[model samples]
Target: MERIKAIGIDAGSTAIKVVGINEKGNIVFYKVEPTSFQMKPQLEKIIEELPKDVPIGATGYGGDLISNATITASEIRCHSKGAHLFLKGPGTVIDIGGQDSKVIVIDQEGEVIDFTMNDKCAAGTGRFLETTAWRLKTPVEEMARFAEKADREVQVSSVCAVFAESEVISMVAKGEPMEAVIKGLHRALAKRVASLAQSLNIIPPILLSGGVAQNPVIKSMLEEELKEKIIVPPYPQLMGALGAAIISMESKTKVTNR
Candidate 1:
């Protein structure tokens, strides 16, 4: 069995990400799941699959809920740390999460120097896209590819997710092409997130993380809007968990060296 040195858990608003790493800073095991109302039991089930007795680090909105964690940190700190590990240079980190979207500027050391987030509205989040996809009767997985085939994207006027849904449905009723509508939706989300990063007056390479990074339409639109290259680390969705696990490994090593 591969020896586990530490583990990190990100109990985010919409998903739970768990990552275990060895002493060499390599991921040994990882898992992602929708956030369950019974998070304790769900987490317990995940932990059971991991190697026992490793130090655990936790982050995200529900980090404190992990009673067994040896250390805890905020999502911003952890994500920046994790991105730095991969980026190895100063850059902006734009994470489009399930419930919120954030733009963070990190120095060459990977420390977060400036950051902004929009948690008050679902305007620029995964939920917004999901709701729009449902209205279009399309799977979220296919939205990007479908949008890519459109010759021109229709403009989605509403900024609010609820209003956007209504607008999309109306367009569908009017015989608007689904590809055009989906592309427009992607543009709307990209612009919303772009504003946050632009507020920092920071430049590329923009490192994108979170569940939304998987969407090609959004990623391409964001790059065009920012006029900069975007960097996506491996397992972009697991960045927070990976960061937490890295911290735990460092802490455990410190104790051993002492």
Candidate 2:
């Protein structure tokens, strides 16, 4: 028997993730790259890294722009599908990404009920943290670690990313520790995200998805704000891709069976 392969692509605002799975749903290959506005070139680059015979399924902000995908899916559907695959419960999903953030409510069967998205501003998203990291002379990857070490409270009052950058700079000039500043940043972001979750009457065992879900500091802050346990998948960032792949495989099976 010949092997069957399925590929999933998450073409996000900042990054692109590609994954290949076998008939048994085992990941056989994966690749990630920075996303670019020029979709064709980027798609070509990612496709070059995957198995040639695999059918591609794409989802995310740039999914519609990719011409090579066998199917293009919505980010919301992909994230919800991905979250349900890992969470397997009735609860909410909070996805904080580079340019936007969203809160999705899912039922027991992994279907989305209600959701809210923030794409207008950079205030509570990963871009806010990135700006803070740049101003503090700290790497973005290490910001969460520094926030974890903070013992004192520092407040970032502004919700606007640009104003928050100014606020962080002023705090630094005032001799505030970097950890405290980062902690404050995380707290502000968590507050915004928590507000979104609360809008949907936050339920327990909230699943955190997207790239920012990997930030322990943000997770800790959000947990405190919501007073609930948060679950982070083993590969938080890859959930969307995996979900898309799973959906593609399932649909193919259904078609074949019919």
lDDT of 2 at 212: 91
Give the top-scoring candidate (lDDT).
Answer: 1
Among these predicted structures, which one has the highest TM-score?
A: 1
lDDT by residue (1-258, candidate 2, tens digit) is 235477789888888888777887666766777777787687877677655655667898888876666766777777887788777788788999888788888888878888888858888788888887898889899988888888986988746998898999999999998889888899899998888778776566799987899899889788899998999987788877877887777665322210
On residues 1-258, what C-alpha lDDT tens digit does candidate 1 reach at each position?
Answer: 478788899999889999888788788888899999888888778767766677888999889877778789889888988888778898888999989788888999888889889857998888889899988788888889999999998998637988999999999889999889988888989999988788886856788999999987788889999999898878899989998988777674432210
lDDT of each: 0.85, 0.80
Worst 10 residues of 1 by lDDT: 249-258
lDDT of 1 at 144: 91
At residue 75, candidate 1 shows an lDDT of 92
Candidate 1 residue 227 Cα shift, in angstroms, is 0.6
Off by over 4 Å in 1: 252-258
